[model samples]
Target: MKVELVQLAGRDGDTAHNLARALEAIAACAADTDLVVFPETHLMGFPTRDTIAALAEPLDGPTLQAIAQAARAHDIAIAIGMAERDGEHYYNTTVLMTPQGIALRYRKTHLWASDKGIFTAGDRYATALWKGVRVGMLICFDIEFPESARALGQLGAELIIVTNGNMDPYGPTHRTAIMARAMENQAFAVMVNRVGTGDDGLVFAGGSAVVDPFGNLLCEAGREACRQVMVLDFDRLQAARNDYRYLDERRLTLPGERIEHADGRRELMIPQDSF
Candidate 1:
């Protein structure tokens, strides 16, 4: 699977226009690309909750339809983030559109500060399989929590795709975290972040990148332009996993599995009466 991380320059509160341009960018970079990952809130520019809410649209709506069409046209799977409006509530949803017109949606589980009042958090954890590759979806702030990435890794996800709209300039915490999660979980991690400045006097760092399971940076975008595509080798990733064999360490002797809260990290519960 060739995953392409596209660092998009999101338009300021212009969902429709940005979406149309998004298709063009996808078309230009879709060749031999199995998956195309875009930035968070690529459709609706990120900032105020009101602006995000106003730009939200229902599933199978115009924005998604355009995305599906582009996916089908390029024969590639595209993963993107949008402020989704389902009835009266909104979610920071990441939608994965396949070449066959199938869409798997994952709402962001972690809500950043000041965004909790705007978006609803998702309860269920789900990952989608595309072309024999187990892929997991996460948004900007969601990747900050180690639990989310570890959960996906334990669930047999080989690649963690993250869509982000974070713009904390002079800080590289998000970038550092992206590489760390990949290293810790032994999974390929790719993050696509929005570039340029938004309405809130916030300037993005624009360090969109992909890291291997060994935590080595594969490809990264520069500061100025937030648009580039790099191909990732699945064969190399599979070789790495085979050599490490970390997934073989998980073994459950009981029928039912349990999760336990311990200290600050969540841990798998030990089987009862096993002494």
Candidate 2:
């Protein structure tokens, strides 16, 4: 799988500008790229109480419709975050969008500072099949918790995607957390963070990166606006999982089974033992 990480700053509450940049990035992605990811709230930016009502949009709103259109136009899967307005409540959400449509959606489960009163937390983690790979998403502060990535792992995620908005003094924190999350789950991890300063004067950290299953950093961005791409080999996944499997050892001996469908589909099937 080939993925591109977009590290750039977004004007807070400016959907028009951000969406334009996002669409442009999607359109410019390499022809062979399978996915393109952006930072947290890349669409709506950081919505304050005063602007939340105007900036937040429902999943089916024009913003997503535009993004879906971009995904279709580019023939690439796009992973990004936004301020999702769901009826009377709002969520910090991320989604995986394929050419067909939305492949996966995950609301931020653990709200960070300022997110507490503005957004409702998501209760569960989920993954979806994207080009034969099981993909899951996390937001800015979500990767800090081990359980966040673990939940996706249990749901059969082989690739973990994170849309981050981490700022000054905390860049190193997520830098370490992303690698830890992938290593612990024995899955590939990718994180895209925002750069430059925000409306509130908070400087976003732009250390976007990609980590392999064995916790090695394949590529990492500096604290600047940039676009980076990496090719992931599925063979590396098997090489890492061929030994002691973390998914099986972390829980009951359900005897995990890996399936490779002739058409290129791959899956890790483990019987559920409800925790």
Write down the TM-score of every candidate: 0.85, 0.91
Q: Give a tens-digit lDDT track for model 1, residues 1-275.
A: 77777776777678877898788878887578888888887877663765765678887788888899888888999998888889888888888888777546778878888568788887544566778777777888878887778767766677889898777753388888899888867888989888788777788778888898888888878766556566667676666777665556656322224343231222232234421
Expressed as tens digits, the lDDT of each residue in 80-106 for candidate 2 is: 999999999999999888888878788
- After the best TM-score superposition of candidate 2, give how far the Cα of residue 111 lies from its true spot, in angstroms: 0.5
**lDDT of each model, Cα atoms only?**
0.76, 0.87
lDDT of 1: 0.76
Per-candidate count of clashing residue pairs (backbone under 3 Å): 0, 0
lDDT of the structure predicted as candidate 2: 0.87
**lDDT for residue 153 in candidate 2, whole number 0-100:** 81
Tell me the deviation in Å of residue 165 in model 2: 0.4
